[model samples]
Target: MAEALNNLVQLMDPYLLQILVNIGIAIILALGLNIITGITGQLSLGHAAFMSVGAFASAIITIRFNIPFGLNLLLSGLMAAIVGAAIGFPILRLTGDYLAICTLGFAEIVKVVFLNMDITNKALGLTVPTPKSPIPMPIYVWLVAIIAIIFSSFMKDSRFGRALKAIRDDEIAAEAMGINITRYKIESFALGAFMAGVGGGLYAHFINYINPSDFGFLKSVDMLSMVVLGGLGSIAGTVVGASILAAAPEFLRFMSEYRMLVYGGLLVFLMVFRPNGLLGGVNFTDLVLRSLGRKPAIAEVREKQT
Candidate 1:
């Protein structure tokens, strides 16, 4: 299968292939953030911190233990999930701006830690061995992304997912209904961090380098933008949103000096006109069920945000 993919990739333009890789990574990152902020209403500003953890973990594993690519990805995610749960336990109790601030601060601390760490070579960064496989990086990335999307779809209809939505909609009401708010919130954080970690591993392998600065505040914001632009709580919307925003920079490269200015302006324009996001609250799971002649398990969350 990998040999076949590699053969197909050989025929594609490198630039276009790179763009596809970027889009796939962006989709994974956006989906991770959506699990936390969009579905669970946990405003995390340090998601990139988890990504950094994954990047370094995966790189170190390859360098030290020579772990296989597939196993390394899972280990990286597991490491990040552990970190996320540790962080989320006490911090998940906070809401709104407070939670955001704490998460941001945590992200900064992570950046600083990596900057001073010995294994990471401090500011010099670490070189990662790119996976030597018949399967192209983009194929691996998109396969994981598709798996993530499928997992999300299943979670959306599960009893656990309903409990999460309840908490998101009304915390006090959800608690009154006997929901274990803290546990569920922490679970969401862990799951989201796992996805981000896997994405970081893919990114590290693809770029062939890992830097502490690479997964910084701006990167987290970029992921958030994808989730927000696509519509919160909408998996399919996130895929579309991430693809457009991820590819936009490459497409606007001709603008050069004015590229970022144009990108920023476009984002501002989108927010002003479609604040809820392009497909805010439009869940693909609901659409699928409807198409299959089945009633959706829960009412779709409305996009209205006052």
Candidate 2:
């Protein structure tokens, strides 16, 4: 099956294939950030730090331990989650800009650690082992992305998800209602970090090389941009936002050096027009259903409208 998929993928345009691959990875990253910042209303500025941890961890495991690819991915995510929980425990007490600053500091600390570590080859980075298997990279990337989406969707509707949402809306009120704010926040951080780590693992395999520089402040900003553009707490919006932003650089390549300028300007323009994001507080599912001339459940409609 992997071999056949690879053969089929090879027939497509390489550039387009690369873009799709990027979008898949971006979806994973964005969804992870969505859980922390979007759904939980935590302002995090160091998400790329988790990705860096995952990338390096996964690469090392593959290079030295020669573990199965699936195990490598799981271990990488677990490593990142563990780190997030550790960091989150001390800093979760801080709120608003203070929380953001601490997270940013944590990210910088992580980057510096990787940059100076001998096991990671210091500034030189690590080379991941190419999979001997014939599985198409996009297949692996998109499959994980689909699972993330489903997981996120389920989380949004579950009791656990509601508790997170409540905290996002009002921490004090949520605490009043018996939700353990600190514990929930830490869990959110861990969950988000796990996803980011998995994404980094996939990314390390796809690119086959990774250095500390790749996971920097800019990378974190890019992840935040996707979630914000897509719409906080909306999985559908994250998918759309991640796809557009992931593909924009390629589409804007014709502009050469001015592409980044255009990209920044585009984001500013969008924010001005849609301050809440493209689908903020809007029910994308209902919109799609309405477009198809089908009706969503009354309860869902009411819930979204509020």
Candidate 3:
């Protein structure tokens, strides 16, 4: 058994390395969307627009100016955040369905602009300059994972995250409690966009090719699906959600044309059976404790009190 296990590990090492990198990128995308729809109660279909903006912006800067990859990523995310803030001012005033439609419109507009823009080569797409030396995928993946962990941890514990949650649960009550709803919502939305932009920048660099079609409504929906399937408000759940959705298609390639049908059907089944998702907003730490046969600390405390 030991020898077999060692052989399996040796065989799986390279694939595992690649999967880790992919998971890091997926986590960034999923967690970013979580801040928007999961935390702030905003439905945005324009996340892909923000991502495209970031991807193109980073690619252009890096290609033209020969900037460092890290700087390119940061600047791209900042630009996307600025755009998000600019658009948020007008469209965020709309609520629920109105908000959704406005964001959808925004995404479409961004797509059309990219399609027509001469700078982007008029829909032919632009080639991103590859790094001079190949950085092992695992290293980049670790960097992204660290960034994601820091961001998720900060947002999960910060006052900003709490305010956003309040807005999600009860907007009116949150406002009554003296929370600045508009500011918080806009901030959350922009932050989400910023993360999406960073993810896009990484994606562009990794793939070294992109087109307007890459960032569309379907992409936004896919991100949303990750957030929902992982458990709306859970960061860990988002990672799991993204992994399953992203990797499942590849694994099901043997089915070919029926793959998508199976995927969709599986999603429907999951929604029907577990509406709250796999982890239902719980974190990995909590899950680990439960798996170790420990009850929730709060529950134990309540029992003691009784």
Candidate 4:
């Protein structure tokens, strides 16, 4: 029994490591989507396009120019951010379904362009050259996770994030409060695109391949699902949502054929039962504090005495 237990532990080590990496990527993707759809209330269906742009850009730069991996990732993210901001100019004018359709069309257009672009192999796809003596997958995953956490933390408290929330709550009221709605919208779009790009770069390196087909409308839908499942405005919820959605299928391999159906059914059930999601609008920090039996500052004994 002890020998069997040791064997099981050995077998699980690698898979556990892989799951950690997947969790990091999922968190980055979910958090990025949340900024656009959750905070800014923009239903974008072209996020995969931005991700592809980053993936391809970083892959090409690393392969062709032999640039440092970090610089390549940064440049790729910046390129996607620029594209996102530029696209947001005209598309942001539309609202609701119209906006969604436009974003969907944008993703399709990007895919089509890549499909015909000879530089990207004209529908064949491109192989990313793996880094020489690359960092361990676990380390890379931790780095990305740290990056996502830092970005989320910064945005959660920033003026920009507040502006985004205002826009989401009521665009007209936000504008009335002297917020530059257009600027905030553009900023939100760009920020989301940037994160998506970083995630894409990580994905490309992790997979070591890229193709137009990988960034389809369905990919966008998956991202949207992450945001919705996590709770629209909750960062911690987004992380949980992404982790579960990403890992659920793998854990349910016995029901592989019915996976999509199960996912859809669960989504429907969740929306009907708890429209706000598991955590609703609660932030992760607040959730953790409450879990630890901590009270709000106003309710603390010291504060109350003061």
Candidate 5:
């Protein structure tokens, strides 16, 4: 099955194949942000900082240490998680827009630090080594994206996920109910950073380039937008939102210079017309079944709305 998928992917137009891979990367990044800002209800604007860390770490490991491709990815994630834990404790104390601004500052700091660091090679950037694995990179990205989606979904149904949601809805009540708000917040931020790091590692290998400019504040905003526009805390919504947003530029290429204007307008329109997002608290599968006049596999996630 794997070989067949690779062969089929090989048959696709190279640009289209790249777009598919891009979507997978977007899914991973958006899901990571969803964990932090959506499920955990903690605003983060420095997610790209984690991604930058992973990208540079993976690139450095690949070039200097000559570690195997897979190890590089894992190490990058670990590196990002460590950094996340380092920053999360102090920063997670802030809530709402204040927290967002703090994270944003953190992101800018990371970018500037990377810009000055000799190990990161300053602005020149590092070139990722070519993969030695037989599996095509796009396939690896999709597989990892699938794993991330499953992990996120499982987290949502786990005890920890419930705690996070409780804190999100009402931190005081959650604390009163015996939830360790601080610990859960740190865990969510670190785990989300880890996922973003892994996604960055994949992107580094896929693009074969890394620079501080690539993972700046704007990149963080894009990931956050994917989560918010997909319906916070909704896994299916994240997937659909990532797909649409990631693919929009390619689809709008015919509009030339107006593409970006149209893109921004479209997002604004969606926000205005559907404040809850495309999926909101609703399950995509449930919505589909309802449209088909059949019972849905999973019930709607009405807790947030109710």
Candidate 6:
């Protein structure tokens, strides 16, 4: 299968191939943010900061220490996860808009730190080494994206995932039920940051460059938009959202200035008309049952359990 994919990738047009790669990267980003804000009910505006941590960490190692790409990627994710855990301890206490403000500030601080640090080339940005043509990178990107989706799906069904859902639904009730809110919150944040960092590592290698500005608040907003517009907790919706959002810029390039206007207007329309989101939710099973004019078994069981 691997050999076949390689051969197929080799035959594809470079531009088309790169577009697919970009979508895959965005999928990873969307999934990471989904884990943090969507599933965990945390409003973070500093996700890009975590990505920068991974990017810069990977860039520094690749440039200075000459580590292998895979190792550098793992090291970068570990670095970001450490930073996430460190930051999550204190900030996880805050909620809603307050948390968002703190995270936005955190992103600025990270940007400034990278801009001043000589290790990151001091705003000149770090250039990652890459092949003349996009090759193995696409495969790596999609592999990670697939793994991320699977991980998210499994997590959504795991014991910890239920804890997260309970917290999202009612934090006080979850705490009352003996769930360790603090531990889970911090762990979720760290885990989300880890995924973002891994995505960043992939971005760095694929783009062959790292700029502090690239992972600014704007990037965070874009990531958030993907999750929110998809439907907060729907992984399938996230994939669709990432695909459309990632592809929009190129598809809209013809309009230039008007492109953003159209994009913003579309988002506004979606928010007003379909506030829950695109797939903003009903599980596939529920949708199917409703379409067939039957009650969902899960809902029946839930009602009975309640």
Worst 10-residue lDDT window, candidate 2: 281-290
Q: Write the per-residue lDDT of candidate 2 for residues 1-306, one digit (tens) a residue.
A: 777898889899988888999999999999999999999999999999999999999999888886678888999999999999999999999999999999999999999999999999999998887855557778889999999988987787679999999999999999999999999999999999999999999999999999998999989999999999988888888888999999999999999899999999999999899888888886555566789888866657788999
Task: State which candidate, 2 or 4, has the greater TM-score.
Answer: 2
List candidate 5 stretches off by more than 4 Å: 1-6, 284-306
Query: Against the unseen true structure, what C-alpha lDDT does each candidate score?
Result: 0.91, 0.91, 0.82, 0.83, 0.90, 0.87
Candidate 1's residue-wise lDDT over 207-250, tens digit each?
Answer: 99989998889999999999999988888889889999999999
- Could you tell me every candidate's TM-score relative to the true structure? 0.94, 0.94, 0.88, 0.89, 0.92, 0.90
Model 5 RMSD in Å is: 3.4
What 10-residue stretch in candidate 4 is worst by lDDT? 1-10
- Residue pairs clashing in model 5 are none
lDDT of 6 by residue, 1-306 (tens): 667777988999998888899999999988888888989999999999999999888777777776567777788888998999899999999999999998899889999999999889888999988733223789988988998988887797689988998999999999999999999998899889988899998899889988998999899999999988889988877888889888888788899989999898888888899888898874534555789998887778999999
lDDT tens digits, residue span 107-165, model 3: 99999999999888768998987754334434655577677866775676578788899
Against the true structure, candidate 2 reaches a TM-score of 0.94
Candidate 5's TM-score: 0.92
Alpha carbon deviation, residue 295, candidate 4 (Å): 4.5
Candidate 4 global lDDT: 0.83
- The local distance difference test score of model 5 is 0.90
User: Which pairs in model 1 have colliding backbones?
Assistant: none
Worst 10 residues of 6 by lDDT: 128-137
